[model samples]
Every structure is written in C-alpha cells, then in structure tokens.
Target: TNNLAKTACINIVTLNSVAFYIFIMSASLPSSMRKLVVKTLTSNFRKAVEIQTVPLPNPASGHVLVKNHFVGINASDVNFSAGKYDPSKQPPFDAGFEAIGEVVAVGDGVSQSFIGKSVAHLSNGAFSEFQAVAGKSILEIPSMQPQYIPCLVSGMTAKLALQESGNLKPNEKVLVTAASGGTGQFAVQLAKLAGCHVIGTCSSDKKVNFLKSIGCDHAINISTENLGQVLKEHYPHGVDVVYESVGGETYETCVNRLAVKGRLIVIGYISGYQQPMGVATTTSARGAAALPVKMLMKSSSVTGFFLFHYANQWKSAFQELSDLYVAGKLTCMVDDGSSERKGGFRGIDDVTDAVDYLYSRKSVGKIVVNLASSGSKL
Candidate 1:
C-alpha cells in the first residue's frame, strides 16, 4: 500500500514538471524569429525536411545577419537530407548551401556598410528564413532574385572546370552528362563560349530543346537514344573533354570515349547520391573500371573537382561570369515552375516538391526555391 502511494505521487510530479517545461519553452519563442528546424532524418528526403519554429540568431563578430530571400536546391541538398552526403550530419542538422538575401544586421567588428546591402553566399543552414554568415564570404548582388544564386556555386564550378581544369581548346569535342542540370547547363554554355563543340546528354525531349537553345551543338536524349551508340557514331575520334556528373553507365562510357590526351572533370555523381554511401551495390549502378590502364594507354587525365577547394578563384570567376551576363554571353536558367503557378514553389512549404522535381530528371536548369513570397516571380 505504501509503495503504490509513492508511485502515484511520482507520476503526478513528473506530469507537473513536463507541463512547466512546455510552458517555459512556449514563452521563450518570439513570434518574429520563426525558422525551420529539421527534427529528424529519414530515407525519404521530403519527410526529413521538417518544419519547426526556431529563434532567429544574431550574427557573431565578423558575421552579418541575413533575411533570406531565396535559396537554391542542389542535388547535394537531397543527399545531405538523406544522411548520405556526410555521416557526421545526423538528425537535426540544418541543410542547404546557396542563398540570396539582404543584410539586416551587422555584428561587432563588421562594417556598418553591410546593413541594407543585398548579398549572396554559400553556407550551411540556408534552409532557414534567417542566417548569420561570415561577412567576408558575402558577395554583393544587384537584387534578391533567385537567378543570381546559382552564380554562388554552379556557375563558378562550370567555368573553372572547363577553362581552368579541362583547358578546353577551340573546336574541341566536349561532352557533358546531365547537360540540362544546374551545373551541367553552365558547362554547356561555357564550353561553347570557349569555342569548343559542345554535346550534351539529357533524358527528355524537353531538356534536349532547352540544351539546344543554350548553344549546345548536339543533344542526346539518354532515355530514347543509346549514349554509347551516339558517341561511337558521331564522336568516333573520341571526345577531347568530358564534363561528367552522372556516374554509373554514363561514367563508364565517358572513360571509354576519351580521346588521346583528353581531360575528364569529375564534378559529382548524382546518380548514386540516393544509394548507400561508400559501398558497392546493385541499385546504385555506380561503377567504372580500367581507369589506370585506360589513362596510361591514352595519356588521358581525370580530375576531381570540389568547388570550395578553389575558393581563391571565386572573386575573379564571379566577375567574369557577371561580365558575361551583362554582355548577354551568359544566361542563368532557374526553374521554379512559376509558369504553372503564379509564383510557384515559394516559401519553405514547397522545398520538398522543389527537391522532388530536381531528382525527377525533368528540370532543364537550376532549381531555385524562394523563401520570400514576394520574390517568387523568378
């Protein structure tokens, strides 16, 4: 009888404690600082992107606070959400890298000029409505348009991969896999600008048309046409430069199709991003072989590219791309499905759908998500 009475008292005390904690938490959250927080990590990326209200953080010394206007959806974002990109990033880790916004506040040791300036940056925690970023990394932009967000990563990557790493020569036969993708589209245009004969591969006729419109000399629909056959017949002499992102069969074919002294740039392998990490398996279809023998026999080279590794080149590269844009030589193709809706995929609610569209292999260009409802037109 005494033990039963003690148990009842303990249960009541526990319930009171829980209620008090909930009340305290509720009272602490300010209405203005609401943000999303990833509550859990799941195999389904959409389910993994959970929405929670978090307190907006203030910038620290050497950092600026940004009110996010737009954010970009890269293939890596999906992989990050799925826990396949970085093992250290377990549940509750914030995802997203590229974003455009206006500086609302500056921290100690930061210049006051940063306030009220429009900027773009590549950083973690971009999935939220507000972020504190190192002021030195911010790039001043003309507006909050999502179009400029790609220039933060994708454009710079494409330029450096071809002009610096690949060393593409005029009239060189260049092939780009996933040509209609965010980074791939930039590669197609940049290769053409370098006077290289650019060929791009996609899965749909819609993307094929988009590629051609962007100066691609040839577009191969991998879904309807055989990538190997097309390369064998048209590029019998082998390709001089290959900007490969899609892995698996596409990667194997690119290795086999390299010309003597050819250069193949490895940007990513989106085809395997959703599969098991760092393990050889069936569903992944991530395979390639004869690399050492093939490279030695042909004097060809393969270079792996990670954009952040070339941080020093960002300023100059952005200047060059911006100049091209002003001169009408560079184009920024952002897919937000705005045509289907008045301002499609605006707000955090549509991020899941935006990511789904990217992996669907249907989008022909960069997939951008607008955080500000008013900035959703692009």
Candidate 2:
C-alpha cells in the first residue's frame, strides 16, 4: 500500500513538471508574429506580397512550432508568386518555401524533448518569424547555419536528379548548366564525386573560377566562348549526362551534345522564368516536338525532375548530403548578397531583395536570408 502511494505521488509530480514546462514555453512566445503573405499573383514579389502581423500559430496535434533562423531564396520564387507552380490555388496565401529553425514547442503526441532542437523544413509560408509544422515533416539538421539550407532543396535536387533521373555512371562525361548557381554547384561537385569529368557553364570568369575551385574539370564562360563550339571541339564524343537547368538555347545545346544513350535531366528553366508564364512554355513545346528526332539519332533521352515529386527520397538524400558536408567532402556555397547589394541580405525584410538578387544572375551560390540575429550552437 505504501509503495503504491509513493508511485502515484511520483507520477503526479512528473505530470506537473511537464505541464509547467509546456506553460512556460507557450508563455515565452509572442502573441503576434510577422509574416509575408501573397496578396496578389504577380511576378513582382515585392508588389504582390505584404508583411502582416498575425497571432502566433499554436502547434496542432503531432506538430511543432519553430522559430525560423534562416530562409532560402530560390529563383522560382517569382514563378510561385506568379502562380505558375499552382494555378488552382488562390491568393492571399503564405509566401516562401524552405527555412531552418529551432523547435520551440511541441503539440500532443510529440515528445517535449523535441523542443529546442534544430530543425529544417521545406514547406509553404516559410518566410515568417515562426511556423507550426508537422513533427515528422521537419528534418533535424546538424545546426541552424544557412549553408544547410541549400542542402535541403538544391543539394537534394542535384543528388537525386543525377542518381535517379540522370542515371549517372562512373568515369562518364557530365555537364552542368548554370554551374555556379545553387543547385548547379551541387550537381558539379556530385558529378565530380561520382568520378565523372565535370564541365560547368557560367556567365563570367569569376563564376568559372568558382566552379573550378569546386572540382569542375572544365568551366566554360558562355558569355565569352560559344558553349556548343567548345563542347564540339573538346568533347567530340559528347557528354554522358547533362544537368541542364537553364532552358531555351541551353536546353537545345545539351540535347545536341548528348552521347549515345545519354540522359539529360531538366530540373528547371530559369532562362524563361522572367518571361510571361505561357510564353516560354509555347517556345519550349515547339522545340521539344523536334527533340525526339535529335534524341533518336543519338539514342539519348530527356527527363524532367521536380524535387517535390520525389518526397520519399528526400530524407536519404539530405542525410547523405549532411554526411558529406560533415566529412568535408561537400561544399555548401551560400551567396552573402554583398556583390549585388550593400550590407547584404539580412532578416525577413530583405527576402524580396534576395529574390531579385537571385534573378539578377550575379549570385554565385545559394541565396539565403538571415532571420535570427544569433544562432544556437550545434
């Protein structure tokens, strides 16, 4: 009888302690938070979106509340705002995509221990001070550093697209368009790591140098040298794999240069993102109809890769990328935004400028906006 009473007392004490912890965590968070919302669907992000203060989101069952520290800016932000990604969805919706932060609170069915853990997530409405996300959806990263932000989207895209879509093989010739850009850099490094001779395309000598430093065997400054001429003269046999992101002319160039049975993975078409939504599609469709003949001649094929479609592979891809990064075998290059704008991109207010910077074609690597003033140690 005495033991049973003592046990009941201990359980009551534990329950009270957990309740106190939950109350404290909830109380510490502000009643209101600022977030960017898309009021209109337009290519002009700054004009379409507005910052608004709203009540802090409570973590729903099986969810966790996170305080975002950094958010990654992608070239596709314009497409998102323009409603290219999803035409069916109507606005006044949340803005932004991927963010890294620390979990501050957990809801029912979530362990209290998860609170204060560093996590990263790829979801809508990431351009906010705080977000409530599903516990399972959040990936616990090594730290909240901006470098890891690229790995969540760009790195995974490169790694998975190459392995699954490109069918990359060892000792093969690989070409990566926009090699100095976010996903392009990873494609270059991953191709090199897979024992392929990597050829990267850039717009300037600076980008060429950056590509070379990241193990690109050949960095072609397309602004100066003709991409087709250089590939034809040096790599007459053609490349076995092409990670073609830049569309239009670059896409045509890649199709013409594919080796026998080669694969070209089309992850994006940034060249056309600035154009009217359907304008690029019309041009691409016309060109694509003729690609069958070119591909048939070389016995090659073209495949489209969208990251969200391969959700099951994300965790494994991110884990491998994180391991490589920790081992110093991978470099997560993040553009500081100083080259384009003074003082660089910092805080939520600078997210729109960061998006513009990405479109300017001046950024060398991943563009990330710093959200937190200080970071928690790994």
Best by TM-score: 2
Candidate 1: lDDT over CA atoms? 0.81
Model 2 lDDT tens row, 1-378: 999999999999988987787788778889998888999988888887998999999899999999999899988888888898899988999999899999999899999988878998988999999999989899998776888998988999999999888777789999999999999999999999988899999999889999989999999999999999999999999999999888888889888898999999999998888776677533467677888898889899899999999999888899899899999999999996866556567777888878888888889999988887522221
The per-prediction CA RMSD against the true structure, in angstroms, equals 14.5, 3.9
Q: Global lDDT for candidate 2? A: 0.89
How many clashes in each structure? 0, 0
Model 1 residue 14 distance off true place after TM-score fit, in angstroms: 59
> What lDDT score goes with residue 348 in model 1?
78
TM-score of 2: 0.91
Ten contiguous residues with the weakest lDDT in model 1: 280-289
Could you tell me which residue pairs clash in candidate 1? none
List ranges where model 2 is wrong by over 4 Å: 1-24, 281-287, 341-343, 373-378
Local accuracy of candidate 1 as per-residue lDDT tens digits, 240-298: 99999987778888988999999999998888776656654223333334578889999
Which segments of candidate 1 are over 4 A away from where they belong?
Answer: 1-43, 83-85, 279-289, 339-342, 374-378
